[model samples]
Target: MDASSDRELPSTQEDLEIRAVSAERLTFFGDAVVAIALTLLALELPVPEGSTNSEMWHSATSHRDSYLAFMISFVVIAAHWRAHHRVFRHVTATNSRLTSFTMYWLLTLVITPFATDVIGGHGAFQFRFVFYAVVQSAACLLFLLMVREIPRDGLARPGTAPEIFSRSIHRAGMVALGFLISIPVSLVTRWAYVCWIVVPLVDSVIDARKGRTARQSSQD
Candidate 1:
């Protein structure tokens, strides 16, 4: 082999540094955009026109179910966005594929309010239920793509303990599994919304465990 003909790799540290900076910006935008979606969606729902307390109470009370669904969906989207942000913060790559995946997932998220309306208004007809669940599920899958690429840039470097990677993967599995399972359940049960809550709970547990482990490692 002609040594001069062989090309050297770009500086890995330099690539990693640029990628890390871009990933932080992308993740920050993702968080803010999702939050904007929730707020705009909430505003689209109008309050009762009645001026009297009794009449307005009646009007507002009539839409309680819709309000409840909106509240639940909003919280789920917030939790999903928050976890996505955390994962990206630990990432070091922000290449074209990752950017595309984030765009795909965020595009799917933009329909969440419409899905919420369909599911809430029509109840769980198999079609609307499946559609709503599928939208969220697609977002979950795209997020998985974004996260699965995390270990590639030495963030999960040598001497990074196996337990940390294992726990992170396990947490991702919980989210993916919850979305996968909930799709069918949403089609079957009236209370399928409850299943979505499993994701946030899983996130919380993973975050708590991560915090405790880091503290212990630092103490040692």
Candidate 2:
């Protein structure tokens, strides 16, 4: 009984394949949780209240902050799901660490709707902004861990392109850095949103420079 219990990890390629099926089931579970989170986000949206068209238009304008927050959260969650899908596609096995990291990642996703509400609130601008940023940054970093785990633990499929993992890591890191940088900026000004928008453009520039350097090195 002790020897059988000690054998926690799969010992053969067949066992790895079997575990891959279980990992895929976990991915499906994650998809459902993400869908539920999105639903919760939409349900929290405030309806424009009015008796007439003009009044309704005015009410909508008044609730613009909530509308804007919903849109932002929607996009952020969708992007995270997309990245999650990409990472899990190459995954061929899993370990306890990967499972734990995935659950934590999902927890962040589930909290995003509440964070959106906080962002839409009227007072304590800096505190609310920083809180939202922190949630997003944690989500990004946790996802980076998930991405790294696949390769680190030999969880990815054979013949999978290495660039897939590298690209995901870089993007997650850039996004996390953007949110972290915005936290301090939020202390001084509401313009901190500029950080999230600009960081991707900066990442693109860096990638282009690296590609050029690589090509030149090959030529030399």
The numbered model that scores best in TM-score is 2
Tell me the tens digit of each residue's lDDT in model 1 across 1-220: 5554443334656676787788778887787779877976697574875879999999988887678768867876886777676565565557677788888888877888887787667444767777877787787777767666656545433454545545555665676677677777765676666666677586888889999999999999
Clashing pairs in 2: none
RMSD of 1: 5.5
> What value does the lDDT take at residue 178 in candidate 1?
71
- Candidate 1 backbone clash number: 0
> After superposition, which runs of candidate 2 have C-alpha atoms over 4 Å from their true positions?
1-14, 216-220
Could you tell me the lDDT of residue 38 within candidate 1?
93
Q: Model 2, 27-88: lDDT tens per residue? A: 99899999999999999999999999999999999999999999999999999999999889
Give me the candidate number with maximum lDDT.
2
